[model samples]
Target: MDALPDTLPDAPGERLRIASYNIRKCLGTDRRRNPERTMRVIKRTAAEIAVLQEADRRLGDRPAALTPEVIAQASDYTPLPIAKNHVSLGWHGNAILVRPWIELEDLHHLDLPSFEPRGAVAADLRRDGQLLRVVGVHLGLRTPDRLRQLGAISDWLATQTRLPTLILGDFNEWSATAPLAPLKPDFNVLAPGPSFHARLRLAPLDRIAHCDLWEPARTGMLDEGEALRASDHLPIWGEFRLPG
Candidate 1:
């Protein structure tokens, strides 16, 4: 796979690429449920860690839309066991996939305050003595609920050990500032570009936010090849230089 562009020169710090995508339950914009195609788009990102929203179906048991077996066969990533049940791949459809070489130190499923069943997943990953924390979320539809969910996430993070952290997913909020204000105090939130309505590309619904320990090298949206037909929201990625 081709390497993602980086603005920074060679440095002593570790460089990591993380991506966020809303697979829409593996139902593509073409109106077909193709998990393999979704995996192909993810593989194209060449990300070390990928946080996915709507990874599982809504009704019934909320089984994984993209099965672990398929992901294992398609790429080197291994899905973290954050699901509440045996069949689901994530907690409330928020899932995280990382390279198998990365060690998982801790994991949490955060239940947010909302009228709908909304939640987020937090995972501590370690490699080569460097530790990183990632939180994957899919916020509720209403603006009020979105703010509440962000507050809930902040409350949950307040109790955890500090580390280089990244918060990513389909935020579901159209306006950039209002709903995400709660996170502004601590994180450097960035929306790479417009990724929603993948066919035409209008709104910037997907985003990545990180704390002070990491410096963003570059950020972009995957819009080529399979990405155009993969889902309604294109995958957004960011490369960050980890603290030495």
Candidate 2:
């Protein structure tokens, strides 16, 4: 399995590694539910912040698919309390996990306009005096709804104080540009690589977009070991350097 580099060149800025993954509720392509294996793939990314889709079951209180105990045992990251209910880990199956040292200043759970129960989560985090905004979303299947969801997110961000921001998750859009128009003018949208249908690797549905305050360093998909079978969609990651 290929792991992302542990450290980057000691340049003039602070660096951050962020990743997005659709864990399919911890149900892998092998038709098995193994949250441990799913977390193993996440650990491989070595992301300081991870935006995850389908982290909880869809029905009946929406219980978390990846329990806190499993996450604690496998990694050093802590899951944000973005879920509305006590049983779930995220809102509408979208969750954010950050390293223990990162300070969470604020958070919001957005209810998107869609035919189904779809939502997004946003967090303001501070590390080493650098304040960053991160949004995690899992959009609807239809293109029109996806556009509307992005617009809603854009509108929400417009109301907040600007920071080095990142929006990442399973966008569920085939073309990275069209549906993501609302964010294009200010954010650099990137589809690291084909991450869907993990076994075949045919679509670039998972993506990360960042504002100009940060410079993109590297991005790629995790394709080896548990990553290949832990979920139907492989994890995609991005490394960015925030100027001091």
Best by lDDT: 2
- Summarize candidate 2's per-residue lDDT along 1-244 as a digit string, tens digits: 3457654222223568889999999999889999999988887887888899999998899999998889999887899988888899888899988877778999998889998878889999997787889999998999889889999999999999999999999989887455478886988789998899899878899999899999998899988878989999999998899766
lDDT of 2: 0.87
lDDT of each: 0.86, 0.87
**Model 1: CA > 4 A from native:** 1-13, 177-179
Error of 2 at 207 (Å): 0.5
Candidate 2 wrong stretches, greater than 4 Å? 1-3, 6-13, 176-179
Q: List the residue pairs that clash in candidate 1.
A: none
Query: In model 2, what are the clashing residue pairs, if there are any?
Result: none
